[model samples]
Target: MTKQIFKPRGQNTTRAIAANVFSLCFPLFLVDAVRRVHPVALQQFHLLPPDGADLAPGLLEDDPRIVIASAWIDLTDGPVVLHLPHTHGRHFDLTLIDTAGEPFASLGTRTDNDDGVDVAVVGPRWSGEVPHTHLARRAPSDACWAVSRIHAHSPLDRPEAEAVSRNQHVSSLGRRAEHRTDHVTSLEPPAVSSLRQVIELGPAVFFHRLDSVLDRAPIGFERSVRPLIDQFRRDLDGPPPVSSWSPDLAEALELGFADGLAAIRAATAAISESRGIGWHAVAVPQHDESGASLAQAGRAYSSLGAPAREELLTLVCEHDGHGRPLRGDRSSRLRFPPDGLPPVRGFWRLHTRPTASGDKRHGIGDRNDLSPDDDGALSLIIHDLPPAPGDLGNWLSAPHGEMCLIMRLYAPRGEALSGAWRMPPIEIVDLDVDGSRPGGASSESLKPNRRTPS
Candidate 1:
């Protein structure tokens, strides 16, 4: 007797459409997740002051030792050349972010240009001869962002670093780029944007924007995804077409959008479990294929423009060793054992958020003038007040209300990149037995996890 095979009815009908629609919207949700973080104006290269004075909310990683010249770039027309004046002997790194909000390329002391040089960034669609003197880099996405970091060696070097950073400029290929309004961009509000808004835009708008951006710098993915994305592109676009499917299926679209968002959020929460003591570190994967997977999009949404692990490892501490949340109203101490400095070829910088008082403190890693204990351990007192009359650099300011610390390990290799080197816990000090007061270890502090900056 032959067995009968049962096939589901209308497998290629509404059910299939719904699944494809769901699949299409999930990744787009991640893309916009990256984009909403693209807050701040399209203003080119705004210089963040070393003291972090009048800081706006949502600054990811900032400090007194570095000056950042940040700007939003568009490659809709063609390739654009990023220009940096001669650095002479200053350490600098310029990171370019793609549409997915991932740092696709970096140029400066770590990669190339020990001194300085012109670098032309060409997208997938652009084809032209870059000037022989300029280094040409092929980018994965047309919509990009530029974040240039210049290190300030000392009090005397800040002004020079700021000047050098401000001198950087980007020139479009061919004729002067006449700004085109049709160029694709994220939700760029004068203020920072959240993920909810982007998700709310739903499948229609998100897919449209994705198509426009990919037109300039298309990233090819695997069979399962590439075909669906292309099908939607073709169906929604035409000379004479049934592309406008929104009005007819408005109700279905809304319901699907709501259900998809709820499902994705629940799944994401289960995935982002607390993994470390008090520090939360997110590293961009080495080969994150564009338009290929969910992890790449998720990384961009969480860490935004963070560089790859080989170049930098950013760690954030919002609490202390006792599982107590960090509060800005109190004080704390970050102690490092002798030979404890993160062993990296380039350098390491510790950033304290909302603590403007200790902006003038000396080098965080200048061991020559450091005052260490007999055990060779170094402890840096963090408070809103200044250190003693003639004490060598050890005081980091605490904010009046809230706080957190950001540590960047540049050129991380060996133990630092591996799980071997652990982050030193922040000692919550200057509190009473009941968690109130100032002076000594009280066991309470304001080091919220790395995200929004006050």
Candidate 2:
């Protein structure tokens, strides 16, 4: 017997199963590799008024008025330029922040006669950090107009060498300060700076990887990728606060390579946990034209479009407790409801901040400013000021025109999403002169109410 020859029966079956799995998941791996290598490269530079430039005084630690100009980037091998004007006759600080609102770098300069400073940044390459140059104004001017030009170059190309030569030209712009602010009125430069040569490879890679992952991943896994990508972009291109670290090239390089990765990871976690259910609705009361009590308002308006129909208002019933919707409170701006709102064993709050145009600003407002009713229900009024004494609990100030409401529900029970836990509908009610509802007409009888200054 020539060494009994035998073949395994299940070998082919095992191989086939493995091949199928690999075929489904190979694209995701390729995409992930690309995404990891092609990170978002951003450079945002802007000028800000000095500490005491405004007559009303500088912004406090929490005020949103301190920002002047900002920019963002999401890819490498490109150049970005900003021409910042110095109109207030004061020296301005030029600052740059990555997407995480972390400071990247800064260049301080003085200007007179309105001639601003010029800043140029080069993205990283295979070599060490790319060299950047800053040219200080030759002479002082009343108002400085700074021009920024950013460039992105391919690592494969002679990016480092070319950047050096291009930087020389950028440096030359500061050689003479005699030119007036109107000297270069043309918004379009004759040629784009070399830094702009780099391409935004991160966005392309991110999408490609996302497509691959979705093909083989569970719905939750697939859904989480977007927030991660968004966070990556944001960390790479948002504004830093004033108290942040001073902007320097070394700091930016470190943040770009390190903190950027951290942001991506955090975003991935958030996306993974998100259930993908966007908005849900709860039941409330409906009213008739004569202000008579009618039927109950159900979940139909949950997805309805705004400027809501007459006799109907849809309040966001479920949200992460961050803030409540209120009308006249200024301190409630820039708050996010606590994450995940539902009817549970926790407390809830809601508030609203009036936009300049009377709409709600994105992602602002939380529970700290809302007043609760006698029965423990949260009340909100959309008027511009505190309602008369009795109605204070429900009065929220509305801008003169259109407005939005933000509500927060905290520690909501797990049953909230399934409708097992129900919250009373947010009713729109009319306030009498003394701020109390007359005749108890209910929320439906509330006419178009006004609470702002005459």
Off by over 4 Å in 2: 1-347, 352-378, 400-404, 430-454
Minimal lDDT window, size 10, model 2: 291-300
Cα error, candidate 2, residue 314 (Å): 13
- For residues 17-101, what per-residue lDDT tens digits would candidate 2 score against the true structure? 2222222222233223222222223232222222211111111011122233322332233333333443232223443322111
After TM-score superposition, what is the CA distance of residue 352 in candidate 1 from its true location, in Å?
A: 3.1
lDDT tens digits, residues 1-454, model 1? 1111111134223223433444334444444444434444453455644432112112344555567665666676678777676676677777776554456678778775857787788876788798898888877666666767787776578778777776776667644433332332222332424344455576556555655434433354332355655554454342123265655454544554555455444444434436445776754533445353334434433544445566777777877788776665566677777788777778776757655553665325542365665567766666555444333255565566666777778877689877688778887664444463223322333222233323
* Model 1 quality (TM-score): 0.68
Global lDDT of each candidate: 0.56, 0.29
TM-score each candidate. Answer: 0.68, 0.26
